[model samples]
Target chain A: MGRLLERLDKVDRRVIYILMAASVIVPLALKLDFPIPIGSGPSMDLYMAIDTLPPGSTVIISFDYDPSTKAELQPMAVALTRHLFGHGVRVIGMAMWPQGASLGQQAMAQAADSLGAEQYEDWVNLGYTVGAGVSLLRMGSSIEAVYPQDRDGVPYDSIPLMRDVRRLGDVDLAISLSAGDPGIHSWVMMAKDTYGVPVGGGCTAVSAPEFYTYLGTGQLVGLLGGLRGAADYETILRERIPGAPGGLATPGMAAQSISHLVIMGFIVIGNVAFIAGRSKRKGGAK
Target chain B: MTMEIVGIWLGALLTLALYSFLYRDNPFYKFTEHLFVGMSAGYWVIYNIYNVLIPNLWDRLVGTGDAAPDMMMIIPAVLGLFMLARLVPKGAGLSRISLAMIVGTGAGLSLVTTFRTNCLSQVEGTIIALTGAGTGQFLSNLILVVGVVCGLVYFFFSKPHRGVIGGAANTGITVLMVAFGASFGYTVMARISLLIGQVQFLLFEWLPTIPIFRGLTG
Candidate 1:
């Protein structure tokens, strides 16, 4: 015990970092899997939110995330889009992040292609915009004000999916996959509150807890929290959306669980060393 | 053969390079970090300028190569330009124009929506099922409301406290600490999950695939 404590006390930060990195990498490489005891509230809410939407309903998936977020947020975005398409939902894709326009369009395009969805008829891309939160407010008043045209520079009226959608009120659901300030909170304040449209979100794990308050307030019907939420969402998708090729969620959960164990391990070691050092000093004093 | 596998392989390598920084501050991590930042920023700027600024605002200004643009684009362009004026020493006053435009637009939205979303909805949520006030949710809410009130009171250190006020204040601290610990646990889980995600990509995506990577391992 004394020897283990002594080693733990002097263990270099580099060693700790290496262990953490391995903790993360090994599970991913070996495909280490773990049990996912679903937290019912957010997971169930997310499942119900998309499932309840009327088939062929023109649902909007706001890919408010960027590449920085693709890891955590993308699976949910893809899963939900798949779910929407599987149920024959007419979907329009858009992004708040400037880079997100292409990323969103690309993600939707890939999913659409994979799912036998045709563009313009099945879906369209509203693409990126400036002004962020303010732009969302403008969307509440008039989506056409901020986005007069789709990504192709054709007017919103020209796109079949966009034809009747002049404001957020025209949409059945507004789902924003967000990472930061200009993401979910922006939509909640702008489109949902102003236009009275139903809204839900998927945010990065760091930002997820702050939004439980919103869920409680009913400002958001559901929130997909970070990667775990994404993984959970994928499970819902595979079950709900028939013939959806799945990899993301199960593999993702494997990674998440391993990392948690790694961190817990380090924290335990750190505490033990601290206690041991204190005891050693006390013995010397005696 | 699969683009999916290719994407995963590259992601795994990048994850390794990034996580390697935990060992020491080295050129590898810095190189990867800078590369990621640069690529992300470049991708963002190009998409925004082309998709957002040019088509939405500029096409309306410079004409769509057919008819002259209407006067509507002028105000926004000018407002955008005024934002740049802050860089000029003598024209620092122009920043106020940009500030006001942004602030006015933001404040206008915030005023209406904050009330609708935060205040009104939160108030409504706090009120339990009036049909069945004896439920568990109602009891939980009663405890919460007390916690919220007493917690707020604890922060009000204007005057000295004695008796019930002080005792309640102490109880509020205990409540806050417990809540904080739960929140901390959740956050710790979330972060560790991120670490896990990166590693997962490295192992499953990169190691078994990618010719050069596979050869090196073999």
Candidate 2:
């Protein structure tokens, strides 16, 4: 076992790094699409939530991620907005993270263009709120106190979009695509629980399980987790939009599958080595 | 094929380069890390100013006159600028004005909202119907409530105890630890999974078509 350890320890880590990188990259390049048997409960609930909304019902979405998660969460945000506006829902968007507003704008604009949804008429952006969770919590009742003006700082009263909107009760639903602190938990704690609005969310995979307890109790109507969640949300979108390019989900899933298989293989090989070395050491001692 | 293959190879190399840090700190990891940070920072600054500050703040306060005056914009606009005062040494006192506006309002907001939402409603959500239809729902909500209560108690950093309350607090600590451990495990898996995707993209997709790695495929 000591000899085995010595030998294995000498093996170059660069080789492993190289091997793992190949495991992720190749599958994505092939445009491999392997759909894991995902439960439709969450996906379907999300679809129906947006589908069932009254036409032009006011809804709010907060983009709570920065560029680090842009690769995974952005696509889901686009698809959800597309689904929301598709139902003729009037939308107002906000951001918690400073970098979030741009991505939010770009996504809403794209989804709006695709659906021929007019901005400020059907939707408007409030931009990044400086105070994070506090902004939403307070703005629920008096929207003007938090944002005296629209995104361009035009007086809130003057903007056609803000004219009739006041308080959390006016918003039919709230959704957040979150990364971490000041994200889903904040909205769940503030908007839904405090203000009595229904909430739904999407988050990175690592952040999903803590939320499952929320899901189980129905704090959040449904949730999409990590890259898998994003891909699943995209699948629902493709089915709805017919022939819409599914973006990164297809490649993302393929890359994920290949990565999993590779990691599993390494674990198997490692166990074999452990067993073999144990017997060999016993023989040497004997 | 050419463009697609090239992208795969680049992504794969970056994945490998990033993973190099796990072995030990090295130039490969540093290069990729810096590039990622730099790109993300550049993207963030541009977006913050152009999309957020410009549309949300600057354009509103000092309009180009292309748009008419928004007289009410001056208030929040000045408050927002005070936030930048935190960077100056002498003027750092001015930053407190920003901090007060942000923190005081935030605290007030959370105090009212947190009680009703996090405390009261969660307590209500804690109720469960241990019977036919909502059985699983009931059980899950029960666990969630217990977890959240014990979890919050565990985080209390004040006096340690020796009685029944102490025992409960200790148990709460255990629950939080287990939860944290599970979170860590999930994070490791997600990162490893991401790394694996990069490698697969490189080999199967990139190598098969690229001039440099085409030989490896053959």
Candidate 3:
């Protein structure tokens, strides 16, 4: 039995990998729907921030993530876009990261298409600019000065989206969907602090804790942490706006909940083995 | 085959190739890895040439539309060209000027803001009002204050960790460990979320085309 215990401790890592893969795949294949309790703090704060916006108010959503983080960040982007467009709020899209521009354009199109929102009039893609936070600082004064043209090289003046929107202050709210640096941090620093515009957005779960300080200080109105956060936002959005398309995050959350349980179970088993090994060693020493 | 089906198959093949690294690093994994890196680098080059260099640098220098050519743009243009000098080993020394300007501008801009936002704001956040009415709020505030102080003390290496100071330092270390553990747990959730996303793609998005899983999706 001791020998068997010792071997269990050294079981091949490939087996663990297989188990992890199975845990994720099975829940998804079986279409498992786990009830996730949504905390009414950050998620609620973010929802109300947009919900309270008077119709016809413009919002800038900076896509500061790329394809690598699409799975985690894109759902929130899509859902947020849908929420804003559903409520007749105009969106002005921009990107801090170069690759994020395309992703933003795709999300904007999907959201607009579903609602029959007009392009250029309802929303416009300003594409990407070179400077990280510096571009944001420039935007605090003049957006046209920072981005001379839209993504297609059409002069900013020609675009109808900018007919009323001139600078960051003219917009009611700004949210940056970020995966890393030059994202939420940059928006908070330049947009909120400098321009006095309200800032909020989603980030990877890994980055959520660091931004909690910002939330505490009210520098960020609210935030969506990860897939779970995205799921919460989608749920609330669907509830508010009937017949809303169930975005990827809802099903993603189902898989996330089950996989988390599987991981927790492994952690428990691993710790038990470690404790047993330690006790046997202590007994041998005695 | 329809373009959509071909694209899906291509994506699945590449996904499998990348996942091959889990079993063992083989030629398929290497090929996909190289293809990804090479394609990314090439894409950035092409994108910047049109999106950045042409619009911002070139258009500004040549003065498109009703605007006159701005001579001031020449200085930065030359410096940017010098940035390319690093590609040639002989001209590598010339790249230092561009690098110096970039560093100088970045450091000068960030130095004050970093101090103000990260240091001052964080300090202000830590100094929460303890006189809040609710017991729950007060206790939470108390924990926040203690955690902040102890976490800071844990980093204070100047004082000798002995006696009473040692006790406080130990508590600080414990707080730090708990914070680190929470962060690690959050990171694990983030990674598992990524895995779930990939599995979802394979199972739902890719598998639907096949006859077996068609009914499952429907």
Q: After superposition, how far is residue A14 of candidate 1 from its true place, in Å?
A: 2.1
Question: Could you tell me how far off, in angstroms, the CA of residue A37 lies in candidate 3 after the best superposition?
Answer: 1.6
lDDT of 3: 0.87
The reply for model 2, stretches above 4 Å from the true place, is A1-11, A142-163, A238-247, A264-286, B1-102, B134-182, B189-218
> What lDDT score belongs to each candidate, Candidate 1 first?
0.77, 0.74, 0.87
- TM per model? 0.89, 0.72, 0.97
Q: Tell me how each candidate scores on DockQ against the true complex.
A: 0.54, 0.28, 0.69
TM-score of 1: 0.89
Give the C-alpha interface root-mean-square deviation per candidate.
2.6, 3.8, 1.2
Query: Model 1 off-target regions past 4 Å?
Result: A240-243, A279-286, B1-16, B65-68, B129-135, B159-162, B212-218
Candidate whose lDDT is highest: 3
CAPRI tier of model 3: medium
Write the candidate numbers in order of decreasing TM-score. Answer: 3, 1, 2
lDDT of 1 by residue, A91-207 (tens): 888888776776778678878988798888889888877777777777776887777778887776677777777778889998988978688888888777777778889888778
> By TM-score, is 1 or 3 better?
3
For model 2, the TM-score of its B chain against the native B chain is: 0.68
For every model shown, the clashing-pair count is 6, 23, 0
Per-residue lDDT of model 2, residues A74-136, tens digit only: 877888888887778888888888767778888899989988988778888887776667777
TM-score of chain B of 3: 0.94
Ranking by DockQ: 3, 1, 2
